[model samples]
Target chain A: MIDLSDLSKSFGGTPALTSTRLKIAPGELVCLLGPSGCGKSTLLRLISGLIPPDTGRILLDGQDMTQTPANRRPTAMVFQSHALWPHMTVARNVGFGLRVRGLPRSEIAAKTEAALEMVGLRGFDRRLPSELSGGQAQRVALARCLVVAPKVLLMDEPFSALDAHLRKSLREELKALQRRLGLTTIFVTHDQEEAMELADRIVVMKKGAIEQEDTPSGLYACPATLSVAQFIGQMNVTLATARDGCVAWGGRRIEMPVSGDLTLACRPEDLLPDPQGVPAEVIRITDLGPLLRVALMTPQGEALTWLTPRAAAPLPGARIRLWPRALHVFRGETLLETIQPQRLTLEEDA
Target chain B: MRRFPLGGLTLLTAMVLAMLGPVVTVVLWAFAVKWRYPQILPTEWGLKFWAEVLSRQTITGPVLTSLALASVATTAAALICWPAAFAFARLRFPGRQLLLFSFIAAQAVPKFALFLSIAVIFLQLGLVGTFPGVALVQGLSAMLVMIWIPTAAFRAIPPALEEAAFDLGASRLRVFLAVTLPQAMPALAASYVLAFVAVLFEVDSGLLIGAPKVTTMPLTLMTLSAQVVVQDAAVLCVMIWLPCFVLLLLTRRFMTSRGIAEGLGA
Candidate 1:
């Protein structure tokens, strides 16, 4: 387990990471998910002892490891670029840490082979990093860190180097390996789907600070902030007046919190065509392989998107009534209420 | 310039040949037994002067001295430059670019001018005509190379490779030895060759700093060229060019591993 207490860092008088607190469990895979310059990499570097934190205490397995050098700590990182020593062969790269520990040659040799085997590269011991394909080299890099049997594994966008298909397969393969090893891992990536697929919990970071931290589904369904709602997925938010735990927008009322300056936010998937709902003119329906992304303009001139079956979407310029199955109400950045479909049914009954 | 497709190519070839012109002249001079200033080619050629230069103990001493001094200078410069280059490449300082520029500028300034000014101190310290002093003086002329080329080479090494080594629990020293140094090897090799060749061919520093007592190969060749027998200087030139020719042949394989170049660009 690692406890980051009040961890903050600044580069050139500009804050890279704000005072942040987080607890990572022993065997949990947590992804620091964010776009570029969001301090995800900064936090990882601080934890790995690559850079000194401006202020913080990092407690690793109940020890104050903030001052400990990266070498002394039972932690290892697989770099984003896979950073394999260009000169060393696959076996030697895997055995590097053991060699540093001054382990006997035989032991290092045996373990290196085992590590190569573990990463499914048993015959790749003699190959230099340049000889390996992108996927092969990535495995070798993984084997290199895993050979040391580190307590925590930090991966910084390891799959970002590969093509789409390779990225997906390697992602699954790495996820399986992480589970099998039962290692506490901190994976960093900007790709939301990759985070959702791999991480047990995703920490959404923005502007050097975490916006929200939760399970993928939880974050998707219950985004606490307007940015979180918009960042997590395609969310359509419209200005609405809240009254008596309900929001009035587009001639229809959402049963939610009462506020003067509340905004109704709903994911593209949550918006569905209904006979008795707010009116909209379908602008275009784009085929998105699994679903058609329906583009619409409401009577109030609010642009909206809804993912529906190709057959379900009305043709362009056709009028359709739509209902938000769930509406997340946010006043400024704060989420006020989550009005479900039952509230709409209850409002209909009333 | 781009109006004609082959115009740029012709210009580039002319520039390359212009640079190689003196080198080609030296090679031709090495074989020329009887060549006058008015004539373009030598009237005659023979290996007789080669045997005479090789047989002479006076000529061989400076040849050996030149070899020894170049080796010592190369080693010393490498020791000084490795960490210096690493620091300049990896670390951030207020005046890094300025300092790098100043050092690189050291290469352009003639060493004879610098040596002349520093000779007073060397004379006072009783190191003026000594082998160590001469070699050390020769090293200063090539200091920019010892720092600059390797600095570029080490800079070409990705910082991530070192970080990965550290992440795997290797100490700073181990990272330098096992990871960083190896990555910079090709560049270092190329730089070492350059430094060695630079020291070997240095002319004025030996006369300015190591005059009277010490004799270097370039100095010996200079004196040989001043002699009555023109063929003797030609033979000495061949002797000087031979080893460097072999070194150049070996250089291609080392330079082909452009890992450092790619790393720096990245």
Candidate 2:
């Protein structure tokens, strides 16, 4: 287990990470997800001890490792660029940490070979880093870090440099390795899809502070803030007026427990076609094979997107009504409530 | 079967003649015993002058002194500037750009003029006509290569490599030794060789600071060319050029590395 408490850092008086605390269970892989300049990388660097935090305590298991140097702490970081020593052969690179620890030569060699086998590069020990392909080089980097048997493994967008196909394969392989090793790992990436696929829980960072931290489905289902809702997935929000447990938009009213200036937010897929719903005209339709992304403009000039099954998608220029299956009620950037409405019966639609 | 490229052939010939013409003339002069005016080649050729120049104490002493001066100056320049180069490459401090510019600007000034001013300072400090004074002056000429090439080489190494070493449980010093230094070695070696050759051929500092008591190879060669026999002077020139040519040949690969081209801003 690794625990970070009250971590904060600034570069040249501009805060890169504000006060933040996080805890990761042993064997859990938590991804720090955010766009560039959102402090995700800074947070990762702070945890790895590459840079000191202005105020924080980093605890590994129960030990206070805040003052320990990066090398003294039981943590290893795999960089986005692989950071392989170009001069060293794969075997030598993998055995470097053990050599630093003054282990017996035979033991170092044995552990290096085992690491190579684990990363599935068994016969590639003698090749220099320049001789390897991109994926192979990253595998060697992984093996180099794994050989040390670090208590915590930190990866900073390790697969971001590779092509998409290789990135997916490597992500799966890394996830499998993380599970097998049961090491507390923190991976940083800006790609939400990658974070969703790899992380046990994703920590979404924004503007030097964590915006939200939750399981993938939970975050998608119940976003605590409006920005979190907008960032996680494609969401459509339209202005509405609320009064006495009712929200009204586009001359249609939904009975919900809310009052004051409101915003109705829902994912594109949640907007269902229904006769007794808010009316809009389809501006465009994009075919994505199984689903159609329908662009609509409400009467009040509010634009929205609806993801519907291809067979049920209306043509462009067609007037249609959309019933939000689940609506997130936001009052001034705060999610007030998530209201789920039941499907209308056939008789009611008629 | 294929027609030769007339333009390329002419350019190649011109380059070969332009570059090799002086060396070939020097070699002939070193070997010739007698050659009359208007004669295309020497009437007699032998190693007589080579033996005479080799046997002379004046020639051999200056040759040994030049070698020592070049070696010491180049080594000392490297020792002083490598850490400075590393700092310039890695650290962000006030006046860093100004300091780096000063190093580059040091080489741009006419060397003799610069050495003349430095000689005056050396005279005030009682360092004139001393080996240390000559070495110090020669070492100044070496500073550009010793600093620039190693600085560029150190900069070219991604910081991630060092950080990776640190993350893998190596201390700061160990990371530098095992990771950073080895990566920069090729450029460092190239710079050392280049500086050594430059110092070896350097004349102004040897003339300005080591005069009266200390005479180097370039200084001796300059003196010989002025009044000594042409054959003896040519022999000394060939002796000076040989080591430089061989050293460059040995370090050619390193010279081709990015550090040299980038450091020189080529």
The sequence of per-residue lDDT tens digits that candidate 2 reaches over residues A89-158 is 7898899899899999899999999999999999999898899989999999999989999898989989
Q: What is the alpha-carbon lDDT of model 2 when measured against the actual structure?
A: 0.87
iRMSD, per candidate, in listed order: 4.8, 6.0
- Compare the candidates by lDDT and give the number of the best one: 2
List where candidate 2 sits over 4 angstroms from the true fold.
A243-245, A279-283, A287-290, A313-319, A341-350, B1-13, B32-46, B227-229, B254-266
* CAPRI-style quality class for the chain A–B interface of candidate 1: medium
Q: List the residue pairs that clash in candidate 2.
A: none
Candidate 1 error regions (>4 Å):
A243-246, A341-350, B1-46, B251-266
lDDT of 1 by residue, A1-350 (tens): 99999999999999999999999999999999999999999999888888989898999889999999888888889888889887777887889889888899899999999999988999889888999998998899899989999999999988898899999999999899999999999999999989999999999999999999999999998998998888888888788776676666566665554658887788888877678877888898889988999888887778989898766757899988888888888899999778774425322311
Relative to the unseen true structure, what is the C-alpha lDDT of residue B165 in candidate 1, on a scale of 0 to 100? 86
Candidate 2 C-alpha lDDT tens digits along B100-120: 999889889999899999999
Error of 1 at B89 (Å): 2.4
Clashes of 1: 3
lDDT of 2 at A301: 79
Error of 1 at A228 (Å): 1.3
